[model samples]
Each structure stands twice: as C-alpha cells, then as structure tokens.
Target: MDKDARDFINEYIASLPWLTIIESVNDTLVEDNYVGKIVIQSFKGDVEIMITIPQDFPLKGIQFMCIGITGYPHLMPNGLLCLNVAPAGNLAGELQEHFSKLRTWMMDYYESGKQDAHFEYYIFDADPKITFVFEEDGQKTRPAHCCGRFSYTSLRQQEISDERVWLVTGIGDTPSRFSATFMSFHQPTYEGLYFLLSRPPMINVNQGLTEYEDLLLLLTEEQKGYFFSTAASISIRSGYQTGCIVIVGYEIPSLQSGLQELRWEPFFISLQEYPLKRDPITDEIIVRPSSVSRIHWCKGINASYERMFGRGRLCSELTSSKILVMGVGAVGSQLAHSLVRGGCRYIDISDSDKIEPGNICRSAYTFVKTDIPKVQELFNQLVGISPHLEMQFNIAIEPILDSNKGYEKLKMYFSKYDFIFDCTTNKHLSIMLDGMQLPGRIINLSISNMARHMVVITGVSQIHVLKNRIYNKISPDKREPFYPETGCWSPTFEASNSDIAAPLHYVINELNYRLEKQLIIASFMIVREEMNHSLAYELTYDL
Candidate 1:
C-alpha cells in the first residue's frame, strides 16, 4: 500500500477500539484495489464489515458494508449498505461518519419486529438488469415475444456450477394453454415465468416487490421447481429493454391502477438460489406443476429498432416516410442516397437514362453500375444501404405531357410518396411535368452553366416562376460563361462530381427543412485571361 493509504489504515485502527482487522490489503478478490475488511463488536450482534477504500487516501472516501444477514427490509445483493447520505470530507475527518452510517445499516435489520418489517431479497453475482431473449437454432438474434401466451423448449447447463446459462426456445401461442406434453417426462427445459414488476428492482430490491404467495399461486408444481432452480430475478424483453421499466414502474398515469391495486411494479429482482425441500410423503424432490411461459425465441428486431430510434418523433417519422425520385442522374443520385440515410423508409425511382462511363465524373454510382439503367442501379444501391429499405424502379418512357397514358401513370406514381423530387434538368420535361397536376409536393433540383448554379424549385409547379426567382436573386458575373464540352455536337457544362456533390447534398438537406428560409444560390467559376489572377469569380443570392 502507498504511504497515504497506510497512514489512513493505521489511523482508522487506532481510533476505533471496537473494530477488528480481518484482512489487510485483501488484494486477491477485487483486483488492483485496496479492499481490506474489518469486524465490529456490538451489543445487538457481531457485525462483519468489508471496507473498500481507493489507493489514494484523502482524495477518496471509504466504502463500508455489513455482510451475512437475511430477512426484513431490502438489502443490496452484495450486502453493501445503500447510504442515502454520508459525510462529504477527507477520510481523516470523516472516518467516524462512515462508521456511524454502517452502524445505522446494521441496526435496520434488528429494529423491525419480524413480519412487519419490509421483505429482503437475495442478491446475485450476475448483471441484475436483464433483457431476456430466446436462444434458438435459426433465429438466435430475435427476442422472445407473445401477444398473450406462448410455448417453448429449453436447454439448461449442468446444475451446481457457478455459470448460469439457460436457453428458452420454441415460443408461440399454442398448446391450448393447458398442455401437459412437457410434464410427462423431466427434461432440461426453461421453467421460468413472465410477469411485470413495478420498478427495476435489479439492484434496489425494496421499491418493487410482488408477494411470494401471490406469484406461487399463479404457478404449478413443475414451474415452481423450475423457478426455484433458476436465478430468482425477472427477465424483461420487448420495448422495456431500453429502460421503459423505470417509466412503467414509477411514472406513467395509465399504470397507476396497477400500482394501487395489483401492487405489481415494472422492475426485477433475484434471489441467488432457492433451496428445494424434499416431499415428506413421497421420496421425491417436490416441484409445482405449472405451464409457466417459457421463451422459445425472441423477436427483438422491432424492439431493437424501437430502442434505437424511439428517442425522437422526427427521426421515426422520417424512417416511415415515402419519397419519389424522378431522376437518378448527377445531382439526383446524391439526393436520393442522402434521403435514404436520413431514414426515408421507401424511395420510388424513375429515370430514362443509363449509367455511362462518362457520367462517372458526376453521378453517385461508380463505374461498376455503368451498363445498367440508372433507376435499376440506384435501386440496387439503395437496397445495399439498408437491407430493410423498400424501393421501386420505373423507366420514364415519355415526359408527363407528351402522352396521356404516360401522364396518368406518372400521376398515380407521384401520389404514393410524401415528397417528390423532379431532378431531371430537361427544360421540355420540366415544363411538361409542371403542366400536369401533381399528387404531392414536387422539388426540382439541377445545376446551371458549368455547375456555377444549383437550382431547386419547391411547391411551385411553374418552371417560369422558379426562373424568375433565380434571375431576381442571383447576381450577374462580369465574365462570359464558359461551355465545358468542345467536341460533342451539343456542348454541355462540365462540372466534376466533387464540385456538384456538396450543392446537391445541401439542397436535399434543406428540402427536409421546408421552404421557411429563402433559397441562397452559390456557385464557383474560373476566369480565364492573359494573367493567372482575376476578380472574384463566385456569385451568391444575398436573400
């Protein structure tokens, strides 16, 4: 031990005449910590204490516990006294206060007169907090669930061992609620019960307690035998794993009736082991016969989802939302992927183009998707992003205004999504789509003239209105626009995917924000001249 710890230990021994040193620096059990124990002599009874102090003396305080007692008022599983409050000071000054608190805990067991005292539960070495899942052959990952009741098989490890591993399998709503199939022979099976508790009594056993007689009355002799053999704690699965137990136990007005009448809280407890008594009449070990619910396999996928995204309503809403993408080209591909990551549940894609090798410089999908159609490739990509994602793909044969059949089909397709994105930059197609009545809100996304501009028209179906707004908000640059393609018959603006990806991502994120803020246009351009330096080549819409 360090000098500070030695000094404090010496000081403690000299100051307390009643205390007897059992082990000095009992380093074996608790690893690399000072966990020396002491015994105290008192009139009421002989009290055994386990003192744990940090190696650092004055900086940290001492932890005192009274062990080896049972019955009346709940005690911690480890036999450590739960101090509601103790003095907050250096150990030299507060050792007496720590001793005094231990004295109080010691008296709690004796002061109460038998049955009137609160019930005490035995503590186990395992993790008190538990979310029970079924261990099955095919679906080991899923949680064990039943709407009302279920049947299951089980696998148990050898008894009298320190390790406790119980597998509850084959759960479902069957056996007619009174099947004696498993009762014919004794097999290593799950004999556990499923009941709700008022509090998470994993550690604090006092707050939530269901009567032993009440629980016993509900089970049969076979079940009681199984329950007594297993860990004496409740296992909670379903939506309660991520701490719904606390709310159902102490809060939630709907559960107040259960608290007042049934006195059952939504928590858990464990009695280390139940000692089975032999039947006096028959020479066999006595066990009650009850078809208590045994978990077959757990269906924890949805419960896991709930635990992950249940924190906020907006996230859950986003995951359940349906989105339609009219184009899977340059900017459109980036937008679709962004929306998917934001928890969009379903995305319906429509595009006439295919992913070409040349489009690799700007589109989200890489060269591997080149030969395949853009809509189909994007659909496959989205499926890979989230295996649970629902997606659909369609080839846009003609623009909405070109043919009556095309317009009707497109209209029906648009109706299914909560939001729509018209990402095709074709002017004729945009005007045609604007003319057709949309079933939902449509957002048009595109980049203009050498990727110097990103255009997004929300709510308004008129392409003319978006054009007018862009002209009014954006400022004119002094330099003439530079067309990117020289060899092609119809030269198009050349912009790298990096230069466009940010703007496309920004547009999708802002679309999620709604049209509450004015759209700001930002673009980067290169000024070619006799000299390498020039005036500011970037423009933005101030509004």
Candidate 2:
C-alpha cells in the first residue's frame, strides 16, 4: 500500500467514533491481498460493514459493503452497498460523511423497506452471454401469453476483445428482418416464447426465478400448459441446435406518473436438457415432467423504433412524412441524415455526384473509396443508422431531367412524396421542379458560401414567382469559392462539418416546427449565424 493510503486509513480508523473496527487491516482471513479491509460494526445489529480504500486514495472514493446481507433495495447480491456520495477535503471528514450516508441508506431500507420506487427491479442469477432485444412502448398492451420470433443479423466480436456480440433486428410473431435496399438479409434468427404476468415471478421480494422447475411452478396452470404444449411441438431441425429463449414480462409502476410499464427479462435454455426428456417406457423424446435445469437469464436490449429513434418527442408528421431530398451533397446529405435521425421513416434521395475525397471534410459520406455514388453511400449510411428506414436512392436525377418526356415522369414521381426539398443548389433544376407545380409541397434549401446563412423557400410553385423571390431574398457570396480538385472547374463552398451543422440543425428544428403546426406557407425563411455564435431566424411572407 502507498504511504498516503496507509496514513488515510490510520486517520480514518482513529477519527470515526461510531464505527467499531472488529477486524483490522492486519487480519489475513478477512481480505489479505491489497490495501486490506477494515470490517466494522457500523450499523445497528447483525450487519457488519467492510471498508476498503482504493489505491487512488481520496481521488477515487472508498468502497463499502454489507458483510452478509442480500436482496435489499440498494444492496447487490454480493452485499455491495451502492451509494453515490461526494467526498470531503480531508480523509477524516470524508470518512464521517460516508458513514453518515451509509447510516441513512440503512435507515431508509429498514423504515420504508424500499429506497427507490421507480428503479427497484428483480435481480436474476444467470449468465448474460446471450441477449434478446425487443421493442417496448410504455403503454402498449400485449397478449397474456404468446410465442414470438426475432431475427438477428450477425454475430461478431467486440472491437477491443474477442467476446461475441449479437444484434437482434426485428421482433414479432413471425420473425422479420431489418429492411435494407443495399444490404442482404440472409442472417440467422431464433424463435422464442413470452409470458405476461401481473407481476414479476420472484423467489423473494427482489430475487427473480433462477431454475426451470421454479419458473414452471411460478407460472399459472394455463401458462404451464402453454409452455409444455409449445415445447413438445418445437421441432429440432436436422443440423440446427435445439435451444430457445423464454422472456418473462410483467408490469411495474412508474414513480413519475404512477402508470404501469412492461418490464422484460429473458432466460435461455437448451431444449435437449430442459422441458424435454426421454420417455421411460418407450425410448421416444417427450416433454419432461420435472427438471432442475438452471435458467440462463439474458441481458435485454430495448431496440424498439420508438425507444431507439424517438428523439425525446417525435412528431407524427415526421414519422409518416414521405420526404424526397433532391441532392445528397454536403448540405443535402446532412439534411437527409438529420431528417432520418429526427424520426422521418420514408425518404428518397436523388443525386448525380459521386463521393469524392474532398466531400469527406463536410459531407456525411464516411467512405474514401473512389467512384462510389453519393446516393449509394448515403443510402448505406442511413441504413446503418436506422435499418427499418424505408428509403430509395436514384443514382442520377440529372438524366431524368434531360430524358425525353422526363417532365411528366418527374411530375408523377414527385407527386408520390409529401415534401420535396431541392438541396442540389442547381438553380435550373430548382426552377424546373418548382415550375412543374407538382401536387406535393416543394421547398428549396440552400446555404451561403461560408455556411453563414441557410435559406428555405416553401409553398411557392410558380416558376417566375419562385425565381424572382430567390433572386431578391438570396444574396451573393461574400467569401470566394474554391475548386475541390486542382484543375476541376467545380467551385464548391468552404465550411467544416461543425460550421454547417449549426445552421442546418436550426433550419431542421424550424422546418419540423412549421410542419407540425401546419404553418408551411408561401414564405421565405433565412437562418443566419451571428458573430456571437447564436443563430438568428428571419421569416418573410410572399406578396
């Protein structure tokens, strides 16, 4: 042990009058190895406390534990007393404050019998090697008992370690794959059973079931029949492994609104050993009468659309809106990503440009490979972000603009979407799209040379009117544009991702607000970044 840690421990032992140290650090039977532990009688009766100062000393707080108690509100199965307490200036003051907090925690446990009403969950003793992910909405009602199947895409090792990890995509009655246009869905999936109970099946107040026979006993007669019947009917394919997962769900009251929410706990079992056996008379396999197979409780990851994608509050319009982004360039790609991240499900992206090396600095395209189309790479990225996102990518929109009878095709195609955004910054294309006077709402989004301002023109469909408004409202670039390639004549604007993201986020927030409020009118909106780093929004209406 370090000299500082030893001095602190000596100081703590001498200062704390309330705690009587029964076993000192010199005792080998208690904790022999490291800085050693001081077992003290800090609480009322029968509950001993073990205090150990970490190597970092006062920098990292001390560790405390109840010697032999389990299944309390704040106590872990191994009797680790989990308390969040701040440290003091000196070791003496720190020890006193920690002991005070421990006393308070013990008092609360003894008096109220529960420390936190909202977070008190049953602890199951099982391995977390396998995990099952499912969707959960706080208020969604589910069947009392049902068989569910969930599809998983891949099993790969974690980056830092060789530990295997599984990613479950979609969960339903029949297994479904995560939809993606760019990626194939040929991965393996598993079928599982679920039971909904009034409350969690527990061995004690806070300890959950850990054995298959115990779980069967906890279930109702009807539920037990359902389990046996399903287990018996389960067919083990010739080459496949015989195993399945069982998820137990129960309602727990939320302390905030006093409403009940579903809590799910999964347990995996090998069918060859559990809920299945060979008959005594005939050598045929049958459902087992009783078995003491251990329940392998898995870690549950909530991968529901609402839980994963909902950014706190989601607008219904954004979720259901069919958005068409005209270009997947810098501004366009970021806008498309923002829309997807903000809960827009159905989006179509159109672009003719390939992802260049220079585009990586400002755009969302992370790949540096040559000749990959912008729409293609962007589609892959969006699919990675949200697999359930419904998106279609057109390699080039310029050809459709030039093809014979293309205007009619454009009109027909554009009419299918609810909102069309011209992020191409191509004046001719924007004018043509606006002049088409398509059924859907047309909004043109463009940024200034240095990302100083962003423009959004909504509701105007006339060619001349949109042209005049754009010429009048949009100003010339103050800073000069540079060519990305040495000899290439394509002069693009200069701005980092941070510079563009600030204004783009402002524009997106305003767009969502206007969309939700049904205030998307024939108006011009400008989002300008001030010298003070605050965004200033200006909205003007058409005459």
The best candidate by TM-score is 2
* Cα lDDT tens digits for candidate 2, 1-543: 466656666666756654566655442222423334444443345567777665554566766777766667767666677787787877666766777787687677744476564566677765655655555555554543344444453433243453324555444442333454422532554445667666677876677876566666656656666666664343342112666666777776633265666667876667666764546798444446675366778777665565666645347777788889988888899998888887677899999888788888888976565579999888878877775588889976662353467678767888898888888867777666766677877877777667655666676556436545665656554556677777857787888998788777877777677767987455554545464786565544442
Report the C-alpha displacement of residue 89, candidate 2, in angstroms. 7.9
The alpha-carbon lDDT assigned to residue 347 of candidate 2 equals: 93
Give the C-alpha miss distance for residue 107 in model 1, angstroms: 16
Total backbone collisions, model 1 = 26
- Per residue, candidate 1 scores C-alpha lDDT tens digits across 1-543 of 466656666567656666787876443436545777788776767777777766664456666666775433435545666664455565655666667665665555444332323223233332323323232121122222211222223222244553332222323321211112212221323333443233333323332223333433444455455444433332233222222111011112121223221111222222222223346787344332332221112111111222222343234434576777887887788877776666565678889987778788888778887788898878767655543356777887355454665667766756677666777756676676567656666666767655666766655467646655674555354445554445644544567887677666555455444332434322222221233564233323331
lDDT of each: 0.50, 0.65
Model 2 RMSD in Å is 5.1
Alpha-carbon RMSD, each predicted model: 12.8, 5.1
How good is model 2 by TM-score? 0.79
TM-score per candidate, chains pooled:
0.46, 0.79
